[model samples]
Target: MNDVATPHDSTALVTGANKGIGKETARQLADAGLIVHVGSRDPERGRRAVEEIGGRARLLVLDVTDPESIAAAAHQVGDLDILVNNAGIMAEDAPAPESDLDAFRRTYETNVFGVVAVTNAFLPALRRSPRPRIVNISSGTGSLAWSTDPERAFAFSRGAGAAYRSSKTALNALTVYYAQALESAGFKVNALAPGLRRTDLNERATSADGDPAEAAAGAVRLALLPDDAPTGGFFSWDGTTVPW
Candidate 1:
C-alpha cells in the first residue's frame, strides 16, 4: 500500500522519463502517492513508461530543446508542485581545445538551456502551488571544489569532458539562482549529483556503473524537502552536502 502522503496535494513532472534515471525517478515519485507527469520527447516512449509505472503517472510530451514543445507541455500542466529537470546529454567528452563548438552547443542546449526553458514555462503552474520544488539533475563534475582539487581522480584530465562538465556547472549556477529567486515564494530549488549511474549517456556506462534507481531516490528527497529545508544547495544521492 502506498501510504506516503506528499504535502500540499503535491503533483510532479519528471522530464526525460522514458528511460534510465528519469524513468526510475518517476516510479519512485508515483509510489510516494504524488501524481507524476512522465515527460518524454516521444509519445510512445512516454506511454510505455506510464504503463511501466502503473500509478498516478501521466504522459507529457516535452522536448526541452524545443520552445514549442516546452510551451505546449506547460500549457497542459495547469497546477504542478514539483519540477524535475532530468533531461540532459553528453555530446562528446573532448578536452577544451579538442572539443567542437557544435558539440558544446548540443550539450548546453539540453543540459543548461533546457532546464531554464522548462523552469520558466512551468513557473505559472508551480506558483499556484503552496509548496513548489525544482530539482536539477546535475553532476559532481560541476562542483568547482571537486574539479579544482588535484586529489580527485577525475582531476587527472583537466581538459576532459569540456562540453558536458561545463554544462553541469552552468546548471549548478541556475539552481542557485532559481533557489534564491523562488525561496521567498516557498519554492525549493536545488541541484543534485546523481553520480555516474549506469545509463546510456556514454558508451562506457554499463551495469557496473551503478543502479539508476539509487540516484533517483535523491531527486525524490529534494522534491519532498520540508518547508525549512535549505534551498539552492547541491546534494549527493546519499543526502550529504556537495561543495558548490
Candidate 2:
C-alpha cells in the first residue's frame, strides 16, 4: 500500500541464511540498504554471518523444523516487508527405491513442512506491511514436467535424486496455494530456482562452483518486487518463468 521506499527502514528476514545462497541473499539485501535478519539454527553461525555482512544485518535463531523456533523468530523479527524462505535440505543419497526413507522424511521436514510452518508463523507480520513479499527458494529439479520432458536437458541426467526434487515440487505447489490466498490480502508469494551452486547442502566437495551471490540475485529481485508484481509463479535466476 505504501509506495514510499525507505531503504534504512525496510525489514527482511532470510531463513537458513548462515551459509551458501541464503547467506549471500542476506548480504546482498543488506548491501541494498535493507535491514536483514539472518536466520540460522545455530546462534554462533548466525552471528558470524551477520558479522560477515557487516551492517544492520541482525542474527535471529530459527529452525524451520521446529515450530517453537519459528514462532520465536516471528516474535523477534516483528513486522517485515519481505520474508525469504531460503532454508532447505537436499537428499545426499540416491533416488527413491534406493534412497533412505529417513533422509526423505528429514528433507521434507525442512523443505516442505518447514516452509508451511515458517510462512504461517510470519503471516501476521507480513500482513502488517503495505508491500509484503514471500520468496520460496526452490529448485529446477522440482519441476515435474521439466524434469520428465525428453527434450529437457535435466531429463537426460540421472543425478537428481527423488526426495529433494519431490520436496521442491511440493514447495512450488505450496507457493501457488499461498499466493492465491494472499491475492486479496495484497502480498506477493512465489518460488524461485537459484540454479545449481556449490553449497554444503550438496556436500561441499560435490557441488558445482558458482557464486552464491549470483544465485541470490533472483531471490532479492522477487523479494523487492513492487506491489503490482506477479505472484503465484515460478521463476529462474534470470526472471524467466519456470514450469510447474
Candidate 3:
C-alpha cells in the first residue's frame, strides 16, 4: 500500500456535488481539510456550491455522461487523492414487462457507464497520489441478497425500481472489479450505500428517520481510509457491511 497522507494535503473530486448527499459529502471532506472539487453538470450550480463551501472547494463543471466533459475534468485536475462517484438518476415505476427501455438506458448511462468513464479518465491523477481511494455511491436497493429476502422492508418495493435497482447492482459490480484490478497498485476502491435521502433524485421522498448529512458519512469515511483499510467492500452509513 502507498503511504497515507493527511487530509490537509489530499485532493478529492466529488461528482453531482451541487446538492443532496454529494454536496454533504463534499462539505464534510472539505471540512476535514481536503481540497475538494465540487463537480456538477450545471456550471452555475457548481459555482454556487463552491461559493457556499468557501474554503478549499472549487467548481468542476462535469457531466459524467458526457465523454468530453469527463476528459476535460481529467485534464483540469493534475492530481487526485480521492474520487467519489455520486451522480445518479431515478426513473419512477419502471418495473419489468411494462418497463420503459428509454428509462433503463438513461439510468444505466449515468449510474453505470458514467462511472466507468469518470474513473478511467481520472485513473492517472488518482495514481499520482500517495494513497488513492475511490468511493462509488451505491444503494441498498441494489443488493440482490437483501432484495431477495422476504423479510427486508425494501423487498416489497423491489419490483418497482427495476431500472434504478439493476443499475446500482451493476455499479456495485464495477466497484469490486476496479478494486481487484487496482489492489496491486495500492488503490482502495469501495462502494458506499448512502441510503435514501431527501433529494430531487427521489422527488424529495424521504424517511423521517433519514438524514441527508448522515447518509453522506459512509462516502466520506471510505474516502479517507488508511492505506491498509479494506478495499472492494460494500458499507452502510454506520460502517456495517452491506450485503451484495
Among all candidates shown, the one with the greatest TM-score: 1
| Residue 128 accuracy (lDDT) in model 3 | 88
Worst 10 residues of 1 by lDDT: 1-10
lDDT of each: 0.91, 0.88, 0.89
RMSD of 3: 2.3
Off by over 4 Å in 3: 1-5, 204-209
Question: What's the count of clashing pairs in each model shown?
Answer: 0, 1, 0
Ranked candidates, highest lDDT first: 1, 3, 2
Top lDDT prediction, candidate number = 1
Which residue pairs show backbone clashes in model 3?
none
- Candidate 3 on 1-244: residue-level lDDT in tens? 2333468689999999999899999999999898999999999999998888878999999999999999998999998999999999997556767799999999999999999999999999998888899999999989999998999976787488889889999999999999999999999999988777787776444434577789887788899888778999999887889999
lDDT of 1 at 174: 94
Model 1, range 1-244, lDDT digits (tens) per residue?
A: 1122255457999999999999999999998888999999999999999999997999999999999999999999888999999999999989999999999999999999999999999999999988888999999988888988899866887769989999999999999999999889999899999988999988766555589999999888988887878889999988899998
For residues 69-141, write the lDDT of model 2, one tens digit per residue. 9888888878798999999988654767788889999999999999999999999999999888899999988
Ranking by TM-score: 1, 3, 2
Q: Please identify which of the two predictions, 1 or 3, would achieve the higher lDDT against the true structure.
A: 1
